[model samples]
Target: MPKTLIVVYADGAAHPGDIAVGLASWARCVFVTEPADHTRAMEPLLSQFGPVITTGSAAEAAARLRPYVPDGLVTYSERALRFAAEVASALELPFHDRPTVGRLTDKWLQRDALRAAGVDTVRCHRIATENDWARAVADTGLPAVLKPAHGGGSRNTFLVTDVGEGLELVRGLLSEERPGLVAGGALVLEEYLPGRDLGPFGDYVSVESIVRQGQVTDIAVTGKFPMVPPFRETGRFWPSPLEYEEEERARELARRSVEALGVRSGLTHTEIKLTPDGPRLIEVNGRLGGGINELSVRALGLNLIELAGRTALGEAVPTPDFYRGRAYFQLFHPAPRRASTLLGIEGVEEVKRNAGVTLYRPYAKAGARLPGGVQTQELDIVMGEAPDVTELATIAKEVEATLRYRFAFADEPGAAVTESSVTGAELGAL
Candidate 1:
């Protein structure tokens, strides 16, 4: 019998929709969705697959997909993870177990498991109330990391330097709107260990694998560009550059984490900081890494989404060998100011014309508003690939320097960048 693959996305509008397209090859059917703004560019390619059904709600979409009885289910966001599990259960399709999904989504729960396994990580505790907050401080001490116990892409993550900052951050989080997305309205605080920020120079290691029948397979390690965090991902590069010892430590950490979390199936994206203490497990997501995967999937010449589907569906995935080395992607944001229009992207053509640079994303439209809060993602002006870290960083700098944005309002036009503007510590964050 032909297999069916169902992909659940929050805002269905994904560019270069290869996941949907890839599943279409083997699946007997395919279904996808986005919220109100359905921006899935893969819709055009859906016809090549089986019937494509678009819906408003995952439940509604899942109901529509019921007849197909999909063999596999996969998703990107937490919302979609819940919906995918629901659809899998409704149709009895193979999927990541409920417990596994919970462990993956809930940060505190995952940390508890890691702690139990004696995993070396930053010290952390959960805060359920005012009392819990106070207790957490006493336990972990001041100048720690605070983030929603169950959140992603560094949403509401704060690095509190002192007690006052911690108190205010907690108060703001508590008072702020609760989307009720996760199970609890709790906060997770951890001892903040200062380290070299990995986003700028070092590779963001993504150890990818497909787990099936309580076993993992098809593991692939890739490198990524340094992320400007709290939810900004510039791009990724394949074949991470790691010292022999560090790479081994990361592999061991990833292996232990998968075992500790009891991840039976699906792809897991783990982010860790290589601290002096060793490979400190930052956090693990039991799914493909967004934006990062965009480059890996292309560079590695592999179909991660498809491999994940096969694992979820209890099917065998084709053997995957790491592809050509040294592929990179960059995300360009309004670094100093909100660029309203392209006043000039100086070396864009030169870079494009260069042999090694592969692809580009003109995230902002010509007349689009300048970037600030919500339009931050759109503020990214360019994305392209290079050969190695040196080339990648050089091109990234070149691309950053070339792009010029015409601001909507004329306050001072731009923020002055000083030596202090990008201090040693600040560079780590970039």
Candidate 2:
């Protein structure tokens, strides 16, 4: 008999469509969602996976799902982890303890935990007022990063070169005139981990691991495209091109990091930066990493969504086949910092026709107003496969060359970047 699992779904790494497809054969998944503006409309589509349980709160959700007696519960969204934990505990199913979930969700607490466990030493302080600047800098030093203590997807994150700029940025973030989507409704100032330049690729890599009953199985080390300014991620690829020793070191640190956070089960995505000294911890994600499932399925022939679901249900699953099957990639086109209205975009047909380009997804239609952040303000994404990273670079370039955007800058009246100029992250700075 198929196990019945309750999935607390929301915005995050896992795409609802892919989860729906993955759950069709493995289990009877009842997707529980809150009554929120962003998710209310997706109920129809979510129901395709199984029954849709709509509740206004986590308590209500657990109450409603009690009669069903689901065998397990899972959540892909960091925002919904706490909710899922609550529901799972109510139903006597497996899930992370509240303190572990707190460390996973809160950046300040995670850093503190890593430091306590001797896995990390980066100093971090939560910022509640301007007075904390001196103390923050005293601990973290110059070139610090200001981000939400409980944020992900690099939302409302900034790098400050001086104290004046840091204060100004924080004021802007909290002010009524320019409040933005900040994770956890607060800020964290911490030391920035600089990386050795590995030209053509970002210095960061993530470890994909599946832990079962205190055993950590390290999978592939995922590579990245050099970020656009202000910490905007451009792209990510599977089968990271890290040197043999470095990859092993990364996997070891990831294992230690998760164990330090008391992660004994489920999937983990640990981000690490390749500094001159060694790989440093960049925050561990409790759920699937963004764009991981897409590239993993295409390149490695793995369906992580189903695998994760089954693992949560205590079903035995296969260890990942990490052979270098192929190189899969997703390069995002982020809107320029000042672009407000998307006037026009050129080369959609050309990009789709580009060599090795398998899919071209354009999110913003012409004339749509853009908020101009790192992740959410993305204009489009181009994905494809190559034999290796070296050859994948050529294919990615061809796809990039075909994309061009014309946008009206709201701050600068009548100013627009046309098809003739540089596109993506090259045209602007954070």
Candidate 3:
């Protein structure tokens, strides 16, 4: 008889597809999901492993799982981390406590904890009203970032270069009837670390690791492509192009950041910025790097989802080993435009013919209306690998030139349709 693993499934949960396959080989996996999520796409994938329990609230979900006596409780949903923590506590399963999860999930709390631990981080202030906004500008100065204290995916985040711009952006953000993901509609205004000198690789990289019994192991460093203005992530490449010294420095910062947040057992993703002086903390996540898990598994030859589950079960896990190669993941978005309809994509077949191309998923369908932000409007992603960086660059260029996205806007006088060719430089920032 195998041990049972309980998973909390929701919109932001670890990629359900990957988790389902990964856990099936290790344990009797049970999924606790909302009634809305137990639909056609998820139900069939999850049902293959074990029972799929549907409940409306966290309490109900926990009650349903109590009988299973799960050996581990896990979730990758940012919104469900606290709920999962509570359920794990009730089940006597391994997980971070609510307070620790709070520190990891909330940007303001995360910065406070890191700073108190003597880890380098930027000065930040909480803003909930007009008065709070004024104080933040006065305190943090111009060229700062204002974002939801509890947000993810760069949604509703703004970079204000002056007081007037900050005020205007905050006013608009506050006026929204429903600001999604901004807890209590509060904002965190923090000093901006100018990343101009980091060169084409950008000024930031994310450290991916797994923690067990308060011990952290550095797995890999992922290099980021330049973000669209105001901090929207466009793409990422791994293993980081940074030299050995810089990689070690960022890894150390990540370890300190995770330890300060009191993460005991699970996967951790820490984002750090390399300023002229040294590495500084940007944010820390209490879950696996979203969407990067697939790339990591292919490049590093490690099953992170399995590692996360095994760690929660108190099993001793081995340090990860990597194979030689370079891989990149880039998300395509319709930028500098609003409310456009996706018409079609071209050369997808040609891009797929390349041996180096591993995954090319297009989410935007013909007649689909795209929203305004990077979080909502990303239309597709291209992932691939090659023997080395030079070969990888060539592969990326071929894919970028081969695929074309077509769009149209109804508001235009003639409903003009447009075709944009994606370039490797734009996709990988090479």
Best by lDDT: 2
Ordered by TM-score, highest first, the candidates read 2, 3, 1
- Locate the minimum summed-lDDT window of 10 residues in model 2: 175-184
- Residue pairs that clash (backbone atoms under 3 angstroms), model 3: none
Candidate 2 similarity to native, TM-score: 0.93
Query: TM-scores across all candidates?
Result: 0.80, 0.93, 0.89
Clashes of 2: 0
Relative to the true structure, candidate 1 reaches a TM of 0.80
Model 3, C-alpha of 171: deviation from truth (Å): 2.7
Q: Once superposed on the true structure, which residue ranges of model 2 sit more than 4 Å away at CA?
A: 174-184, 374-376, 412-421, 425-430
Q: Give the Cα error of residue 8 in candidate 1, in Å.
A: 2.8
Pick by TM-score: 1 or 2, better one: 2
Better of 2 and 3 by lDDT: 2
Expressed as tens digits, the lDDT of each residue in 353-383 for candidate 2 is 7767888898889889877665445678888
lDDT value, residue 33 of candidate 2? 82
For residues 1-430, could you state the per-residue lDDT of candidate 1 as single tens digits? 6766676655422332566555656766565655434435555565455566676565777678877766677775565676667667776766766777777877888888888888755678887765677778887887788888777645567767677668877877777665134544788898776545554554346676666776765355666555554334445556566666777678778878887888877777777666656667877777777664566556666666666666666767675564446646655453323223333233446656655556555655545544432112534434556666667767666655554444333334575522212321232232
lDDT of 3 by residue, 292-343 (tens): 6776777766778888888878889787563325655553543423556666
Which residue pairs show collisions in model 1?
A: 12-34, 13-39, 13-40, 199-226, 234-331
- lDDT for predicted candidate 3 compared with the true structure: 0.75
